[model samples]
Target: MDSSGWFMWALLSAVFAAMTAIFAKLGLEGVDSDFATLVRTAVILIMLAAIVLVLGKWRNPLQLGGRTWFFLVLSALATGASWLCYFRALQLGEASKVAPVDKLSLLLVAVFAFVFLGERPGAWSWFGIALVGAGVFILGLKR
Candidate 1:
């Protein structure tokens, strides 16, 4: 895959993420959100582990550098927190509404990248990010 391949991969990720919201909303019925998150995490762990093993990508965590391990651990923690909140939100609200609010993260990511990663989005990129923020707010409005 080349640099241009990323868009297709990202598009597929969006598709799967959409499915995830719908499926999780239905699955949350009669289940505690925290418990549901644990189950979902376990399933993800198993599935990713299988994929890694099948692809010969199983790696020894101990062999990774400290910086890599630290960032990976932090990212995992953040993902866990996000999943917990997302599941709880889905449990309490309509999936359509919850998912759009959840996408406010897209706006946050742009800001975070600029501040922490020294990323500078071009004018149009910032415009797109602003549009995403506006869309989230519009979708989340009580109507």
Candidate 2:
């Protein structure tokens, strides 16, 4: 994908993420966190299956070796855990509060990317990270 395409995807992802927080908060009003997570995962699995079928990528999984399969399964498990924690947080706190705390992952990702991926952030990106950290602190102070 081109840089602009990647940028658009990131922007769209942020929008959807904000909407997800809102929806999760609303959905968890009377539901238990575990049940909500299971329902959400089921829906996501169905959607992902549809996308895989549409892109003819279902067969691509068959070509994976043992190590790749292990990592993929590990990643999926990690994602499920993160989703469950996120929904539980939403159920326990205000969306405005929980969402920003969840977004602290961006700072973690930046640090990990620099250390592992050898990807460096620009000065502006560093400034943005600082701002995000400050915002998270401010949000925490309200609790």
Q: Model 2 over residues 24-115: C-alpha lDDT tens digits?
A: 89899889998999999899989999999999877766788999999899989989999999988888888988999999989889998999
lDDT of each: 0.94, 0.90
- Candidate RMSDs in Å, in order, are 1.5, 1.9
Name every residue pair that clashes in candidate 2: none
lDDT of 2: 0.90
* Per-model TM values vs. the true structure: 0.95, 0.90
- RMSD of candidate 1 to the true fold? 1.5
lDDT of 1 by residue, 31-118 (tens): 9999999999999999999999999998888899999999999999999999999999999999989998998999999999999999
Off by over 4 Å in 2: 1-4
Q: How accurate locally is residue 132 in candidate 2, as Cα lDDT from 0 to 100?
A: 92
Q: Which candidate is the best by lDDT?
A: 1
Winner by TM-score: 1
